[model samples]
Target: MNGIKNAVFTDKSIRLLGKNQYTFNVESGSTRTEIKQWVELFFGVKVIAMNSHRLPIKVKGRRVRSIKGHKKHYKRMIITLQPGYSIPPLRKKRKELELKNTK
Candidate 1:
């Protein structure tokens, strides 16, 4: 990963903020603007809007073990693309989007 090309966005609050968009787990510190720029550059489509938020950290424990490990808190962002251009559903539409960001 170049790690600087800006591929993902991270914001947790976006989960309930968006009406028609989905959120992705990304770098915790990433911002909505950076995501919009990255999406625009990679997918060749215009980003209509974006929002980001931090998810509350939750305490977690190891499964079936006495040891405990804290689950790290992360951020995610919800991005809205132009109505006409959309990233197909990931489950059944992987191939169609496989080459989209290949470069």
Candidate 2:
């Protein structure tokens, strides 16, 4: 967990397909290992493989003079996990059994 646990994750972490792949709002200069560690610790999952993409910097205004600067850049990480382990459902079922103080 040395290189993992950067951020606890924000609401922007969207689920990709159905195989426990999630997208994160990462720093512009985050590396593969750094991102992998962060995701692994945060989600409590074993990270099998990790990939990233650097998005283009967005210019807010049409003319450079109009706006003082452009928007910041971002990097996205696509994480994969081993078999037999899947992420918990994003939503909870109200009808499901609720564990109470049985002890």
Candidate 3:
């Protein structure tokens, strides 16, 4: 769904996968209930719990000018699913497949 931007696969998030949890970058305006419903409907997994936090804002400016800009803000969500349920790998597997095809 539009609310969910993409799956996160940093070292920490990869480790969380072993514990039946998945991490994702979601729209800042998306609520927990909305995300939970979308995940369940899209992935067919039961979400047991969810934790979310907004990533720190990053500001950029030029030394020569007084103008500054802020990067788009987003929220990160860690979702724990019911045992025996899991989301399939997203990017890594697709990239692997593409490489194999190119070879």
Candidate achieving higher lDDT, 2 or 3? 3
Per-candidate clash tally: 7, 2, 0
TM-score of every candidate relative to the true structure: 0.52, 0.52, 0.74
Which residue ranges in model 1 land beyond 4 Å of their true spot?
A: 1-20, 60-73, 89-103
lDDT of 2: 0.53
Alpha carbon lDDT of each predicted model: 0.50, 0.53, 0.80
Top lDDT: which candidate number? 3
lDDT of candidate 2 over 45-86, digit per residue (tens): 788877776545435543333335654455666666776655
Pitting candidate 2 against candidate 3, the one with the higher TM-score is 3
Tens-place lDDT per residue, model 3, 47-100, is 999999876553453233222564445799999999988777653544565567
Off by over 4 Å in 3: 59-71, 90-103
Model 2 per-residue lDDT at 20 = 52
lDDT of 1 by residue, 1-103 (tens): 1112322322322232234354555565556667667667865667777666654553364243222554434555666667666544432233434445465
How does residue 54 of candidate 3 score in lDDT?
70
Off by over 4 Å in 2: 1-15, 58-71, 89-103
